[model samples]
Each structure stands twice: as C-alpha cells, then as structure tokens.
Target chain A: MTRYLRDIFFALAALTIFVAASPVQAQSNSGPLRIEITEGVIEPLPFAIPEFIAGSSRVEDAASDITRVIAADLAGTGLFREIPRSAHISPITSFDSPVQYSDWQAINAQALITGSVSMEGGQLVVRFRLFDVFSQEPLGSGLQFVGDPDSWRRMAHNVADQVYERITGEGGYFDSRVTFVAEEGPKNARLKRIAIMDYDGANVQFLTDSRSLVLAPRFSPDGQSILYTSYETGFPQIYLMDLGTVRARVLDSQDGFMSFAPRFSPNGRSVVYSLETGGNTDIYLMDIASGRRTRLTDSPSIETAPSFSPDGSQIVFESDRSGSQQLYIMSASGGEARRISRNAGRYGTPVWSPRGDLIAFTNQQGGRFHIGVMRTDGGEERLLTSSFLDEGPTWAPNGRVIMFTRETAGADGAPAIYSVDISGRNLQRVSTPGMASDPSWSPLLQ
Target chain B: MKLFSKLIGVVALLALTACGGGGYFGDSPISGAPGGEAAGSADPNSVAYFNQTIGDRVLFVVDEHTLTSQARATLDDQADWLLRNMEFNILVEGHADEQGTREYNLALGARRAASVQTYLISRGITSGRIRTVSYGKERPIEICSAESCYSQNRRAVSVISAGPGA
Candidate 1:
C-alpha cells in the first residue's frame, strides 16, 4: 500500500457507449462510456497497448514488463481482445503525442491504452491514459502511480484495473492472489502443501512443506493470513498461518475431534467450519479473538463447507440431511437452515460469490462432475464445467469467474486448477508449481 | 481430507524401531503350500495368517456407511481373530470413492470406520483395542474410474499391530 496514486481527477461520469446501436441507445442517451456485458450481445472489444514508452534506459526493462502484465490482465478477461502490435498503424512513441484516431481506427481498434514508465524521487513512476478510439477523446483523465521498483507489477495491475472499471463499471480483480494446495507425488501418495500466487498464476510461493497433507487453503479477508486444514499430527485440524512469518498454529484443538473446511467470516473476527466428533459431522462457528465456539448444526448427517455471504449476514454450505449431499443456507448466528439446491444429483463445496448474487458449487450428475452457479434463492442454475472430477469452486474477486480442481481419471489421475467465466466460456487452466487444488482467492490487495 | 492415524500403535511402533509396516498388509499372499508349503499364513497366530485367512477388509456401496451382511460376516471373523490374538491392536482405516466432494467424502469415510469399530465393540472387543481413521478418498486400492474399481475402493481395512509389550 506504499504505492501512491497522484493526479486524481474528479471527472464527470460521462462515458460514451461503444458499438452496437441497439443496446447503446438504450443504455446511453448521453451517459458515461460503458460496455454492458451479456451473452451474445456484442463482439469482443478490440483494443491495443503498444509497448509503453520508457522515459529513460534505466527503466527499459520495467517498462516492457509492466506493459506485458497489463496487457495480459486485460486480454485474459476475454472481454477485450488485444490487437497485436503488428496490427497497429500508430505507435505511442511519446507520452505527450497527439491522438491519431484515424491510424487506430484503421486497425479496427475500438479502444486504446497508452502509458509511459520512468523513475522519480527514487521510485518507479507509471502514467497511463485510456481512450475511445472512434470518439477521439480520452475516456477518463490521465492517471499516474509512484512505487518502489519491486512493486512495478502492482502498479501495472492498478493501471489495468482503472481502465477496466472505467469501461465495464465493475472493479477489476487483477490485483488479487489465490491460495491453494500445491501437490506432488502419485495419487495414492500425493504429497500436498499450501501455496499462494498472483491472480494470474505468477510469483508462486510455497507456505508449507509436503511432509504433511494440507487441503482447502483460504485467504483471510485482509489477505494477511491463511486458514487451512492440515494432517500435521496425523489428524485433520484447522490451522491459521500468518503470512508474515510463514508460521502456523492450530486454531481449536480438542483431543479426538476432526475439523476441516474452515472459512473466515467476511469481517474476519469469526470462522465457520465442520467438526467431526464420534461419527457425526456438523458445522461450528468460533469467535476468533475469544476462541469461543458454538455449534451451528446438530445432526447425524454431514454438514460442512461453510461460506459466508459478502455482508456476513448468512452462510451457504453443503450438507447431507436428506440422505444425500446438497446445499443449504442459514443465518450467520446459527439457526434453522433451508435447503437451496433444487435439482439434485449431489451438491457440495458451495462457495458464495463475492458479488453476493450467486453461490457456486460442485455438482455431481450422471457420473460427471460440474462446477455450477445459482442465484442466492436457488434460481437460474447454470453448470459452467464438466469433467471426471471438477470440485472445489472458488470465485474470482469480481465474481465473474470461478477456479476449481479438475482431476482426470485413472491410476495416474492428477488434479490441476482451472477457471471459467460465469458465462460458461473462456475456460482455461491456471498454472501452479505442480499439481494443485482447492483454490481460494483473496480480495484485492490494499 | 484426513490421513493416516497410528495413534493406537505409538507404543507398539516405538518398540519395533518403526518399520511403519506396509499399508498393503491386508493383501499379503499365501506364500507356501500344504502344512508348511506356504511359509506365510502357515501359523494361525501370525499376522499374515490373520490377514490372509481371516480377511482384513470389507467393501461398502457408494455413499453408504452401513455395513452389509457380508461385511458383518467378515467382522465376525475379524473379532474372533482379535479375541485369540489378545496381544494385538487394530487400526480401522476407512476409505471412500472419488465420486464425492473432498470434505463430504472424508466425513463419510469416518462414519464407515466408526460403524466397523462399533460393530467390533458389540462383539466384546474393548475400545482400547481399536482406533479408527479415515483416509477419505485419498488411498484407493484400485484406480480405475469405473464402478469395478470404485466398489473395491470404498472399503474399511482392519490393520493389526502387535501391542507395545509384545
């Protein structure tokens, strides 16, 4: 958070809608520039990012690196197609260069992003501008970020996020990270450890060794610590690790009970998870500061995988109360829960989207596994992926995409992380150190 | 989600200089023939004999923790063998198929192990003689994606160890 943003302009909310007159007229008689995302409504917005101009030779490497990170961030969304440099007729050779609307329009680029990187006051400084190519005007005021050299990637992410928010009206998720189980070895003897990486799968760092098995690593709301289940003592218990020291301590230890599937309350003061005592598994909530625990469910059926709503008022979770696994929602204070999964095969690993509009889950039907989403009230169910095993769905910070574990079939079957847009398109694998699973995304870094 | 629990055998393992024993102890081959034809499983009091002749594991259907009649029959023999081998301790490892979510499967496996332990206790075995641990869907004897493999995979294996004093 040491990076400083300067030249903040209180620009008027005036966005000119781009392309497709049908929705354009309906959305903007004369409103701000915007792109309303929908299924089959329009084509991908073609945009171009010529190599950001570097002010000095000292920052040449950083200039290119920042450009690559920003381009990858925007293009990876599948909403904006990056027009290759070869297709560009005009190059942003200088930060103060005048607009060449005809040159950009000739290449069919509807939007253009330009920037320059330099050093100032012993810090890496970056400046960027967004433009509506045909409109021939800057979409918003020019912005600049000043940070240490080591933080250039974050500055790039910040620039990309601003461009994204201006066009899509939604906060960007590029500046986030994901914590997951990085696995090694064969399936039967798979050694797993917790690892964290940049949102786009860059800069992976292992937090634990594979000597013990770890599963379901989740970032705390503030992104400073992680909560996961580990078999450190040959039994499953919840462990909370402070990322600063890379050390962990068990959260709640009872002699004979197994606890796992822990998730932070959005406020970060409480946690909800499943605890097994005797043969029954039930949900439990603990006040993190006081270590006071209360049972949220009391049943012979298994109830686990509790996820908090964005507002922290309610929780969505999986249970087998009806003789089969399904999803249910209950109050954050713990009371009667109502089943929300209507169409059944079997559902579990229910994760509430950060947007608070949908709950994503792993659904098993017809012997195939699926990562699907449904409205909070259990309407408009849509399956986004199908495979031999697609489990543990985690949402992107923006809630427009989900990442989950997709393991192939057979003796050598291994798990890898994959993500898909909520529209059931743009499915792709997220690279990790080795095999990985159970990804939980962190909120945008402060 | 859960893993190997050697809690009941700490003392036994400590005394043996810790070989950790093969997890495949239940599937040992009958190595010899008539009288002493097979050096393995020849002595009734031997660990191999208990595993090969008395049976060491029972399979369950998908998502079900309840023991079937055949599973109960195998437990009966297992309980009888345990009574004869009074100096031995048992670890019941429950496993599940890969068809369910990780946490759900872990809990299911725990229930299966508990069911077997409760049944053994009903047959006069002390709770101290048996400890239960769920491998969940982590350890599978067979790895095929088909039901043939999954059926055998959903199993509870009674692993025996000589007690600390032995």
Candidate 2:
C-alpha cells in the first residue's frame, strides 16, 4: 500500500509539472476567447503542419510522408482542419528554431506542429512538439520516438496519437487495426475471406482464404490473436488464429452443436459466444486456457451477440424472449437479465462501448435498419445512421466512433464497412478494395 | 429443313459425348438427375424426382418460423414422398432473408428448421430419419431486396439422402 501510494504521488507530481510548464493564458476581462468545446455545433479547429526537417538526406522522403500522414490523421477526425502548405508564411528549417507565432496567428492557425526526422545507426528517430499559436507557448513538452526504419508508419501513428491525446484529453485510435470479412463475387454466391488492416485501411493482410465461409472476426485484447467462426467442416465452429504465425485451430467444436458470435472477455482469458443445442440457442462462456465451459443463459428464446462491458462485470446482449428481439443486460456470470430497450423496433447486435458508458446496436424498424446507441441502462437512445441495412456496430478503442456494415438495396447490393461518430456526425465510408463487413476494431496498438 | 437437321446433329453429338462420359459435357444434366441416372428416366422413388417433382422446399413469411398453409402443403407432399422412399433419409435446411442481424438470423433459421422437423415428426416420420441444418441468410437462392426475392429466400428445403440401410 505504501508503494502504491508513492506511485500515485509521483504520477500526480509529474502531472503538476506538466501543467506548470505549459503556458496557459488566463481569460481576459473582455470575454472568454478560448474554445471550451463542451457541446453544440463544432467548427473544426484549424492547425498548420510544416514539412518536418530532415536531419539527414536518407530520411528526406520519409520525413515528408510522415508529416502528411500526421496531418491527415488529425484532419480525418473532423475535429482539426489542416492549413494548406502553400498558405504558410513561415518556414521551419531547423528543429531547434523558435516558432513564429505572429505568422501562424495571422494565418488563423490555432495549433502549429513542427518535427524533425533522422536516421541513426539504421534506426529512425522522430522528434516533435506542438504549440498554441495564440498564446505563444508550447502546448506540451517536446517528445522523441525511436524505432526501426521499416516501422515508419507506426512511428507516425504514435506521434499523431500523442498529439491528439494532448489536445482532446482522449486517447487516439490511429495506431490500431480492424479485422473484417472481405467479400467478393455475386450476391447469391458471395465469397468471404477474413482480412485485417490498419485503422486507415492500409497494410491489409488476408488471414483466411475463401474456401470456407467465415464470419465475425474479433481481435483478442492483446491484438496478437483473432477469433472467428468458420464453416470448414460443413458446420459453423469457432476458430482462433495467431496473427504472428498465421496458424489457426478450432476452439470447442462439440460434435452436435454450433458456436458463433464469440467475443473475448476484458481480461482475455475467456470467450463468450452463442451455442445452439436442439434448435434452442443460448450464450456460453468458455475459459480459453482450461477449456472449461459454463452456460451463461439457459432461456429457450434466442439469446446471442453477447458483448462484455469494459470492466467485465456485466454483459449486454440481444434476445427474442419477449416475442421480439430487444436489448438485455445481465451479470457476466449470467442469470436474471433486465430488458433495456423499450422502443418499438427490434434491436440486435448490442456491443458494449470500450468507455463502458453506452451500448451500440442495430435497430430495425419499418423495413429500415439503423445503427444506434443508448446508455448502459438503456437511456438516451440515439440512432447514428439509418439505411437499408446497417448492423454489427463495433466501437473504436476510445468509444468515440462506431464502425458498422451497410448494404444497399437490390440484388447486386453488397456489404461495405462505414463509420460514424457517436454524436451522429462525420459519417464516413471506410474504403476497402471490394466488399467488407463485420468490422472489429483492435485496441490501441503498442 | 436445314435448321431441323442442324438441331438433330447437335442433339446426336450431345448424346454421343454424354455416352463417352469423360469430359465436363459428357456428364448427365446437372439439375434433373443425380447419381448418373438417365436423363429421361424419371423414377418416382428417386431423390431427384422428389426434389424436382414434389417440391422439396417451402417458403415462410418475413421474420417468421411458423409453417404457413402453403408451407404445410409442400411438407405434406415431402412427408408422403419420404414415407414411400423408405431407403432415403432427409436433411432439412433452414434459410432466411437478408433482413436481420447475422447471429439472430442464424437462430431464426434454426427455429425454422426445427419447425419443419416437428411437422415432419407429427406426420409420422421418425426422428432418426431426419436431420437439420440452418444456413441462415448465408445461402439465398434469390438475391434481390424486393418481397418476391425475400419470400423465395426465406425457405426450408428438404434434401434427400440414402440412409445407411440402403
């Protein structure tokens, strides 16, 4: 306990120093000039990203590319708008040069980012700092990251994560990957393969071929393994694949039953999924290590799509026991469940947000499907998007955005992945080469 | 007269190639017959006859698993055919339209297949002679978004297989 308290004291002391070092301005007597950004209409904050200084000739190309990636990452969130490079009045040629706040403020730039990249002993080093132009002070202390030259994109993502966190007070999801089902072929005979890619839809790698049908690819807590259901043996069964080795093995393939919709617990020790027995489906929890199976729900009605709360203390799922599909919450260990959705439509695919505040789901009403969210206790129901078919909502690591599948209407319509902010703003399509669906966002990358 | 002769030559060539039975086109028709049965021979006791003639599939309403009157009529023919063809067992496959969540649709398909199995049992078909599998919306015969396509996709098909005793 003494050691724990000492650690807390040291953390608090560091936080104090961090705030004291930053040059935060006091509110003027005239009015509050600084943006509070509590709620309501949001105009994107404008920022300028000058070309990073290449400390050596070897890293010149990488320096510019990394700078553009960082700018794009911030701009893509719809929270920050990047100032064009042609409009810049000041050029940063040295890593140690002081920022010309007057020039940036004249151009209406609120934030200025300056960085330098160098290659040292076959390793790449990135050093950067953010400044508040209006206050003429650095927003935070300068930071440096060292990594291999091959991992330049990851390094760029790490820098962007730090910058976003410093400004928003919430962790950024830039340094993450999404696992989804890549689909192709005609609609009647669509072939699906499991694919994984960076959060920005780069570095896509197919984990499974289209020989067998697969669904619901989920990442483990550590992002080193994946859990999906495949119909390889003419029956749907859960399989776990090691991302590092690309090897897969079936998990808990009982002779007479099918298991699917599996999700890892918060601790990553157990998996909760739905199992069908004698045509009655129920949720089950299995220990990945010991292979011990425990039934969570024994109801005759269909209960599936179970997602664990971030704390692993509770689970939110969809059930049809009340004559129609609706959202329900119950203890993680299972027993009595309370219906949370009192709306008129049918709700399914309820996934608990990583922030543990809301549950995202797919609500169908009047021949339309909507991606919606509600509080943990089912208050404040808000629909983020509506379409012919939109389902399978997966929360971003910070729970600020949701990615789901949207299929158009027609015979040739195919499923594509899309994302929307939790506030129902900034709806964007995540571009894949072809069709994709059932996206599962990994936790923030290391 | 020239077109008739050309058509006859094509049919004769097709028959010769089918008898040769080595290449892709040498095989029998893909749909009408199974197990290399003759193309024109429609044995009433054969699985193909049951599938093509008696209608091995039954459609359902949207988000419903209960058997409709028309669905029951088809199942009646299926059960009667199964009783006559005692050497063959059956597998009931349940399917759904692309209107619901994947997991829930899977469960719905299961319920649909179970409903068919129950109907077959009530018609005096032994439980041991039947099996069930639910493909949900994964295997849709029709791929459009209209009610016509959806109704066709929401179906349970009775697939026939020769039992172990056969």
Candidate 3:
C-alpha cells in the first residue's frame, strides 16, 4: 500500500508567506544571472506598428499592407502585444535616425520595429531594423531584402523574422513556406492536389494539377524538394519533386505494391516511407541516389509515418505491432524497436525534432486528438495543443515550435494551420484562404 | 479522430484496392442501382428509392457539421421523399474544407452527418434507418481552386440504400 499526502496544499500555503519577505525580493539586480520577480509577473512587450511608410512610386500602396501582415504575423504569437498607433508619442517616419527610447518607454513599449521601402534597380528593396527600448540600442544591424514588388509582403515577413529572433533568441517561422494538400468537393469524391503558400498565406500556389489525392507533403531538409504520396498513378506512389525546377520523378521501387507516407532524412540523402504489400504496411528507407530500398519494419499490422532523428542514426515511426498505434524508435539500420509513448491513447506521426532532443507526435485519447512531444528517451511526454483535430505536427528549425493543421467542423467545414511553442506558450492560427492540410514546416531558408 | 482514421483507412484501402470482398454491399440491389424507384416498391427494375438530384450539394459553416438553412432545405426535400417512400435509408457521408486537419475533418464530417441525422429524425425519419459516416476531405467532387468547388465539397451527401421499404 502507498501512503497519500493530503497536507501538501496547506503546507505550501504556509511556506509562501515565508518566501514572500525573503531578501531576494527586496533588492533588484540587473545582471543576466540575477533571479528576479519576472517569472509569471512578466507581461508581453507592447510596441506600436505604424502603417509602413510606402515609397512614392508607380506601384500601389504596398508597404502599408506588407507591414500590416508582418505585424499580424508577429503579434499573433501572443508574445508581443501590439500597442495601438494612437498611443505612439513619436512618429517613426524614417529608419535612419536612432530611436528615442524615452518616447517609447513613456508609451510603455519595450521594443520598436521600423522599416523603409524603396525601389532599387527596378526591384523592391526593403530595409528594416528592430530596437530594444530599455537598452536604448539596436539589437542588430538593419537588413535589406530584394525581390519583386509583388513579393513585398514576404519581405515584410522577413523583417518580422529579424525582430522576432533578436527578442526571443529563437529563429522565426515567418520566412518559410508550407506545402500542403488543397482540397475541394464532397467527402467521398474529394479532389486534392499539392499546393504551396507563403507562411502568412499571401501567395497560395497550386504546385500539382488536380488529378488524384495527395497526402502529407513534406519538405526536404534543404527546402529544395517535396516528397509526397500521390494517388495519380491509381495507386499510392511516392513522388519526389524538385519544387524549384518543377521537375518530378517517382522514387523507383518495386511494382505491385503501394508506397505512401514519405519523408526525407535529416541529411536529405535518403527517403523513409511506408510500403504496403499483401495488405500489410511497413516502413522502408530508400537511397535517394541509387533508388535502393530497405525495409525497416516487417509486421502484419499497420506501421507507417516514419521520421528520422536529427542525426539520421535513429528513426521514429508509428506502429500497431503492440496492438495499438504507438510511437516506436528504432535504429535507422533497422533493429531493436522500443516504444516511446506510454499514454493511454494511440499515437501516430512521430516527427523527430531537428535539435534531436524530442519527438513530436499525434496522440488520440479520450476521443480527442492532441499534438504532443516526448524526449528521445521516451520520457517527459507533454501534450502541447488539444483540439477537435490537431495532427501532423512539423517542427520549426529551432525545435521550439510545432505547426500542425487544425480543421474545425462547419457548414462549409474549413481547415487552418496553427503553430504552438514546445512550452505551449504561443498558440496562433496560420491562416490560408483555401482549405489546408498536412502542413510540413520547412527549415529556415535564409 | 476516429472518423479521420476511418476515412484515411478507407482511402488507404482504395489506394491499395484492398477491401475484403465488397461484402454486404455487392449483392444489394442498391449496389448498381441507378437513380430513381417507385415509392415503397421492392421491384428490382424500379429505380432505387429517394431520387437524388444530380449536382445538388449542401454547405457547412467553417469546420462545423450543423446544416445551414440551405443544407436543411436540401435535406428537407430528401427527408420528405424518404418519408413518403418509407423504405429508404441513407448513408450521410460528411466532408470538410481543405484548410483543416485530416482527422478532425473526419470527426467534423461525422458530426455533419450526425447533424443531418438529427434533422431527419426531427422530420419523423427513423434514427435506426439513417447511418452516418464521414469521408472527411479525403474525397472531393470539385477539382478546381475556387469557391465553386469548395462549396460543392463541404456537404453531407445522402446515399440511399435499397433497404426494406424501397
């Protein structure tokens, strides 16, 4: 028999009063190592995002809309609350002058984001800088990006990226693109195809013509290729496409079997996929160069959704060999599989983090779907986001954020992509105009 | 989530062409039954009960299954006809827009079908006679990238089976 402790809550209440008057709370220290009362008391930084000053040119108003999108992208994370432009005491019309920090501080803004737009060599060039109001210094030098004026919105996202990184010490997700399946039509006769869009949903481009169903479009580590399963051949076959060149080729494998659920290895040298033969699905690895195939799992039960660890030494996949779908980690060369998820629900879509510390997976328990993560050792499982349906989590390059598709039921049932930090701090919807699914995050393209 | 898996499993089954012997569906007269039938008649030559208007579709709110006024109107006609015939049962296949997750769409689709089932039940149709399944967004009818296709895709289709009454 185990003993139960019922006095813990009461005991903690008495201890709180003693710690309140501790000497550590009396004096304030400014160094990085000082323990301050910032925990739980710290509030989100507030800043004003004035409409970007557009350059006088032949084009329409581009900078204002671009900056607005950037501001929305940054503020959507819930980390930075945007102060209304009405509260700004200083008008930041130019990017050349050093910011007056006192003016911002009076308005309670701890940070300021300023940028300029101009036409250089017939191309749009955007220069942007971010400042820390308290330190009264620029966090870093300003950055300039060149692209078509049509891509001004994307350039704005890049500017937001620079500011986000400087403040959070983490890489930004705004600069990447997500490739997913765009859907239309009835459930039984749904038409789907490959599509790509800017991280903020500005430029939605259909990559493949709608001929067959597509599932799980994963970007290569290098951001150059997409590996996905297409039903176009009348059977699920893994096709690898060079998205930059619009060149497509099927990853060569044996015929008479279906191959689905493809993801590139971390190093981008090999492809891990599920091959179905004789009614059984198993994980298989294919050499991208020689087209050689290696079976990783030999089981009668369904075993799909194979992902590689960052080091490419181990593979994490979902299998029902244990009577329920659970995450399993095995040597990349295929031996000694061990289960990682001990939760009550079946888990699938185990994506290893780029940092090699955790594996993000989809969990189904208590009739709800959740996106959760666990250490590589299968310890410390933490569910990040819970929803009606939140599956297919892909990792940000820094491994601090997880982005997945969240589709809600409605008269015109719609789906949207969403991202949450691993600490479950920032939960924001990544909006796309059309229905979006199977969102695989790309590594930092910068 | 369950419905999403079922939809995906059906899709995978379709991908593999590997479903066990179309059992229970192959021999049924509704298997190859063309659209139409005599009201409450059992004749094999009679068109299957519950005439489905071609290209008729229903709309859903964003990520929800509850029928809109338009969807209710569409289902109302079908429900009235099904009530008159008394022999028809329907399989409501729920679907979702492309913007959502697959499994949630499946659940959303199921919820949509259940919503229709509730509507039909409120309209005096037997709950036992109506079965609900969601294909999620796995199957879409429209292939284009416009609202024209999206509106058509988000629907609860009524597939009438040749049961006792019809």
lDDT of model 3 at position B111: 58
Docking class of 2: acceptable
Count of backbone collisions in candidate 3: 36
Would you estimate the TM-scores of all the predictions? 0.89, 0.88, 0.69
Which sequence of candidate numbers ranks them by DockQ, best first? 1, 2, 3
Write out fnat for all predictions, comma-separated. 0.49, 0.56, 0.12
**Candidate 2 Cα lDDT to native:** 0.81
Evaluated with TM-score, which candidate comes out highest? 1
Query: How high is the TM-score of chain A in model 2?
Result: 0.92
lDDT of 2 by residue, A249-301 (tens): 98878965778899999999999999987688999999998899999999889
* lDDT by candidate, in order shown: 0.80, 0.81, 0.67
Q: Which stretches of candidate 2 lie over 4 Å from their true place?
A: A1-41, B1-41
Displacement of the residue A415 alpha carbon in candidate 2, Å:
1.2
Docking class of 3: incorrect
- Number of the predicted model whose DockQ against the real structure is largest: 1
Ranking, lDDT, top scorer first = 2, 1, 3
The TM-score that candidate 2 achieves is 0.88
